[model samples]
Target: MAPNMADDVNRAVSGARPRLIVGISGASGVAYGVRTLDALNDLGVESHLVVSRAAAMTLSQETTLSLAELNDKASVVHKIGDVGASVSSGSFRTLGMVVAPCSVRTMSEIATGVTSTLLTRAADVTLKERRRLVLMVRETPLHLGHLRTLTALAEMGAVIAPPLPALYAKPASIEAMIDQSVGRMLDLFGLDWAPVRRWQGMAADAPE
Candidate 1:
């Protein structure tokens, strides 16, 4: 690398604000990832987003919003094939990463460290740095292999949080349920979101 280019890279990284890398894979619930970016924006956290091609297909099928509409929610958007992207390196620095609605395929790729795409490569970087990496795995009817893979990831220091709605929140609508789930995930990064249905105590909500 050239001297000037090195200086530019250093300046860019040194000036980086608190940020989180958001990954969306081809999973059933794209909204979890979408709202995750929105919540990060709400909490004044910069979001770097990368979406798999399969995820783009899933988003079109599940929501009326276009791809640009979803991309607009993020502070920075990187091409999935761009392995040279800033988030691909641990030197870039971030709060960590959260792959909302993480697909089984993506999870398996990250677990084995056989990263073929920028999405998984960035996840590999996060894990290597010992940074918090949360995977909102959205699959169901898990077999033994899936369970074992999840265990391996947990041992590797990745948090596996399935978006199971907290029934105790007594959610009135699906959107509320989604928010509650997303908010709780943000809690892992030490971010507080108002929509979280926090458990106060046995009589948690007995009017102040």
Candidate 2:
């Protein structure tokens, strides 16, 4: 049976646990997606995760955790090829979707609406539903085409949040930097994470 849209809507309004779809593409920063799941877990949000094949390769190279261990972090794990998953429908009624470490290929697929995987397909669904779709784009040294693609996606209501470190937070290590960026991404969904060092203001000093 198809999921009851009404029930999902009611649950959303009745303070039920919020749901967010997490997509991990074949970007360099797999740690961003991993920490996103961790933050969601800490916030009590139900996470629906879909990781790309290339991401599996990147994960193997970048981190010690196996794919199974990474899947264990999510509330629900959707296979990359499972286009028929619950998150693939707008009626699932989620807070929205976040594509952490969003790769150029995945972002382009989403912009073109020619999604080849469940990861991009779910992102497409998020956009069509007018929900907040935040893409933490991970590429650097972008050329003109990349700029244009990002512009198009921005026009389509997707937030292009590059996971740059918040130097203002005075992060002590690389992990702190990652957490800060992850926290800010969660902020888009109005989810407050403890590790986010919100700016208070310039401290009064004699710099003048």
Winning model by lDDT: 2
Q: How do all models score by TM-score? A: 0.90, 0.93
- Provide the RMSD of all predictions against the true structure, rounded to 1 decimal: 6.3, 4.3
lDDT of each residue in 90-150, candidate 2, tens digit only: 8787878999889999999999999999999999998888778899999889999999999
Ten contiguous residues with the weakest lDDT in model 2: 1-10
TM-score of 1: 0.90
Residue 185's C-alpha lDDT in candidate 1?
93
- The CA lDDT of each predicted structure is 0.89, 0.91
Model 1, position 174, has a per-residue lDDT of 90
For candidate 2, the lDDT comes to 0.91
lDDT (C-alpha) at residue 190 in model 2: 77
